[model samples]
Target: MKIVELSMVLKIIPKVLQIFLNFCLVLLSLILSFLLIKELTMFLKIFMTDGSSDYKMFIANILIFFLYFEFITMIVKYFKEEYHFPLRYFIYIGITAMIRLIIVEHDHPIDTLIYSLVILILIIGYFIMNITPLERPNRQK
Candidate 1:
């Protein structure tokens, strides 16, 4: 009887953890949505108030906004695709992040070149993923 009960508890553990993780993800999505909105508002405010004098800041904020948007979309895709995140979305995020890093922190020429290389690698990976056939391990054919 004790062994049977232990087996049941072990089975329940994964379900509980899955539920907890889903709840956390939902909360994160809400937070990111709010942040995305805030970034939009900030971008607009900067545009209207200061004109294009702060072009660097303006561009940086735009990148941040897109980053938030991509994360939210990735989370939504996660729930839609049966909790499986596609590799392409991650590669897209990586490329965007590297570009943003290059734009925002170009003080060092070597660092910017390295970030460009990273972006190039991510793009190549994305192309490779696209060319490969989709393999859904958990799908029932």
Candidate 2:
């Protein structure tokens, strides 16, 4: 009886922890989204006041916004897909981040080359992941 009780408690502990972590993730995502919106608004305000049209800054901010949007999407997908995070979303985020970095800071030839290589690697990984097939459960006849 004690062993059974202990096993049940152990199982319940993990479930409880998972629930708590999920709740925390949701809260953090919400907060991050709000902060992103606030930052976007501030960027707009600065652009309006400065009157200096910097396309690079504009593009960088847009990319940053997409990053935040992607993060929210990942969090939502996590809940929707039974708490499993799809690898493609992470790859997409990585690609977007790399592109943004290159756009914002491509000063050195070597650094740019390295970033390009990393992006290529990530793209290949994404392609490979997409091509891989998931195993289906065997149904007994």
Candidate 3:
């Protein structure tokens, strides 16, 4: 084989290994995240005998579910070669985190409103940055 092909083969060996590891991580993250949601449900069922706090428990469970979904989405993106470190995912996580904060701090109306708006602005900026197509490829020049 040409040296170039041999070198490419050598380079690809590590990448294939990484793909296996990436798949394991994705599976693990999905399993663990769902397990957390399940565990939270079990906890709610056991502790909610006192129905006075039912609304609080419901909100808490929903927040847990949302956070788990965000984490699984991030892990799936890690398998991408071009976006192994996805800043957009981080922004998404941040926005979700802010929403969680708002839900938890609803009593503080001003702070809750501020954080909600911040999350809105951040999501808008994320779309603006990511949705625009890349500059033309060299062949188009």
Question: Considering every candidate listed, which one attains the maximal lDDT?
Answer: 1
lDDT of 2 by residue, 76-120 (tens): 999999999988999999999999989999998898889999999
Per-residue error for 3 in candidate 3, Å, reads: 19
Residue-level lDDT of model 1, residues 84-106, one tens digit each, is: 88788888889888988988899
| Candidate 1, residue 121: how far the Cα is off, in Å | 0.6
Candidate closest to the true structure, highest TM-score: 1
Question: How do all models score by TM-score?
Answer: 0.91, 0.89, 0.59
In angstroms, the error of model 2 at 74 is: 0.3
Predicted structure 3: clash tally: 0
Candidate 2 wrong stretches, greater than 4 Å: 136-141
The true-versus-predicted C-alpha distance at residue 18 of model 3, in Å, is 6.5
Instruction: TM-score winner between 2 and 3, please give it.
Output: 2
Q: What is the lDDT for 28 in model 3?
A: 88
TM-score (C-alpha) between model 3 and the true structure? 0.59
| Tens digits of lDDT, candidate 3, 20-136 | 887788788979687777967766685766655666656766776777777777777776555386778788778878877877778888998899899989999898978988695
